[model samples]
Target: MRFGIPLLFGCVVAGSVMAVSCKRGEHVWTAPDTVNIPHNTSGELIRYGRELIVHTAMYLGPEGKVATISNGMNCQNCHLEAGTKFMGNNFAATAANYPRYRERSGSIESLDKRINDCLIRSLNGSPLDRNSHEMQAMIAYIEWVGMTVNNGAKPPGSGIRELPYLLRAADTSKGRLVFDNKCRECHGTDGTGKYDSLTKEYVYPPLWGPHSYNNGAGIFRLSKFAGYVKANMPLNNARLTDEEAWDVAAFVNSQPRTEKLFEKDWPDLNTKPPDVATAPFADTFSAVQHKYGPFGVIVKSRKKH
Candidate 1:
């Protein structure tokens, strides 16, 4: 089980650089803060940088499997720890080279489009809405990461990551009952999300155990889980009310999950998974992010729901 951000080494060379004003379409040189990285390999900071990269790799989520399968995977699965050199496919630099891409979406693509490509092609999932906050957040996060490491690196798809933990006091019994009543129909009485797994190939993975995020993934918080479920649950029957989503989350997460740590040649044991830091609410995502509160700025789209 390995999951983490991709790693980059050296520097990537894109189209010839031409200085331009701060205008959006210009190639203005934006220097990165290289203070933390050392000027020389023997330097202390360099060593730390290496260690940081290795450790940080552990935080990356799994890479996406082709969306045709219900594997319940993300890009972090394959490019484990940003291609920390273990089992990654090394596509970190692809970000800088895209927006000029020609893929299944047709025409050129931006970084977001590329990410969506992976979503549709590899994750067996639908593309996120173009202007969604989640989409934008993911875009920003990935771009920022791509700029790091200087060169192209990807993490391995070993399903290993420092998952944010589910709160111990989350009242799994309440969650369990809610799950049994509302979610069990699709997720299966066993909480394996087996319906999706059977309907799609590797598209919908079980929420716990070997197929899903390891203990390191710790995707136990309610908001992140609820958001995903609310936005896309019931196997193409999305459109869950916010409260319902929260209740469903309580139930689903209440189920049992393995505690053993996954070791699939992670870049570093010291570093945690990337999502752990960026997770909407981290360990206790439910209480903080949102539960039965105001769901302002919500959208009502007319899809297959």
Candidate 2:
């Protein structure tokens, strides 16, 4: 499955591979270019997969052409540039690593299952049919995106960066101020987001309310949301300090959104991350603390045990 592209050397930081380019000097990881894809059937599938990733709502949203399923938000709404942006929940390492065990689901998951997980949780929708062209195209695109990377390598910016845990619970009131000042222009004052009637999708995704990611979605975890917001937010003017990011994430997650029941998740409680917003934790931390932390203690307790 090699793409025959030369590997760029990069340094490791916090256990992930950072990019090495002549200009940046090992700072940024770049996704492979789409133009390099072959002019073949598989390439066609890969291209279609990218389309699915970019315009998932057009094909799969409530008013979708392919199937009426997902909430109006597109996959790119969370994935950012169809999962090519660094530290923006991109899929740069996904294809290379998956069919791997996930602590959240507590099992070895195929890429297909992973996509469906997003459909169910993040998109607040039902799973796409596995055999459908849309599904196959998405798989091809995601695999092709990561084909150049080594197997089992998590490139430095593959996913959301883990910000240092705050010493206190994230303050929703303070977060509200941050959102009103920095986030409201794009996402709207009510947090319902800007709607595109022509495209029938969100131009800027809702931070909360019924259409946003459900409780079971990864970003519902304050850490994940904060990291994502700090890396990319306010439509390119992302200057939120770490504290501001953490607070705003708390504020957003506190708002009403969709809910999902993950009765089978986290079968191994010990492997669960501290920010999981649910009950029956491996430790005795209150659910509120688990949701909005002061997580340094929880993390330390886990390491000690």
Candidate 3:
């Protein structure tokens, strides 16, 4: 998470010296402020995009106008700080690298496609119309953040920073204790997150329940959730060790949420991530192992084949 000087002044282009600022990092990307955007249509759209992410449930949940595709969770639940904060599943580099090939879908995907994937899986909801203003706004916001990032370059701290896998399976029994001590305060004893009455929204979103993310969500995958928990759980004060995060992630994911909405996800079975909850996999591992995992064995086997 090193930093480079943002401001630079130089060059005799048209006999003028111009000052420019650069965003640089290897493990952390600090997104630019929305305040810097001019008061124009593009800026308005970007602002709307940020709102859509932070308040996704209000716009696309059961009561939304555009569509009702997701469970009640907001997109910000996973992509923390409206996709700005590093190691919090930030979107600082999404715009630059997308419209690229993805093995999961086995096609070159656009930014809207990726967002729709989240809507379909992570939010346990349906996809947005690609041409819809809502979709366009979300894309605009992501593009604004990563406009300076070069294509194919995963800027520092662009995505979730996964922890090294443990030698043994993550223990949910241990996770229960960790949840009691570290997470219960905000996320609640039953793991149903707290609600803010005045705002009429969840303050601490549920980790599991009818309102939570579905089995197809990325967080349902142990490694992804574990890494996220390690870096951003406990509500702005992340203190879980890597192992503890893994265990807790297992515990939370094990609880019932929405069922998998679609079956035909990974077209290329070989490229499927080990933690995908879909069954009838290419491997002989048990479903329990796939869900909670001592996943290293599966990973190794895949490499050998």
Highest lDDT among the candidates is held by which one?
A: 2
Evaluated against the true structure, the overall lDDT of model 3 is 0.79
Worst 10 residues of 1 by lDDT: 295-304
Select the stronger candidate by TM-score from 1 and 2.
Answer: 2
The regions of model 1 sitting more than 4 angstroms off are 1-171, 195-203, 260-305
TM-score of each candidate structure, all chains considered together: 0.32, 0.91, 0.88
Per-candidate local distance difference test:
0.39, 0.85, 0.79
Q: What digit string (tens of lDDT, one per residue) describes model 1 on residues 1-305? A: 12222223211113322111123222212223335333563344333433322322122223222113223554443333433321123334545565673422235568776655454433334566668644554554444434643333322211121112333323446556666666677556665644322322222245654444433332443545655554445543455555556666665554555443323323332232222222233123333223322222111111212
Candidate 3 residue-wise lDDT, 225-275, digit = tens: 998888778867777888999999988887887786455678877778888
Counted clashes in each candidate structure: 63, 0, 6
| Top candidate, metric TM-score | 2
Residues 1-305, candidate 2: write the lDDT tens digits: 21222334654433554332222332345677877889999999999899888888899998899998898898999999989876778998998898899988778999999999999999889998889999999999998877766889776677887788999999999999999999999999999999999988899998888888999998899999998888887666678899999999999999998777798999999988898869889999999999999999999999998
Clashes of 3: 6
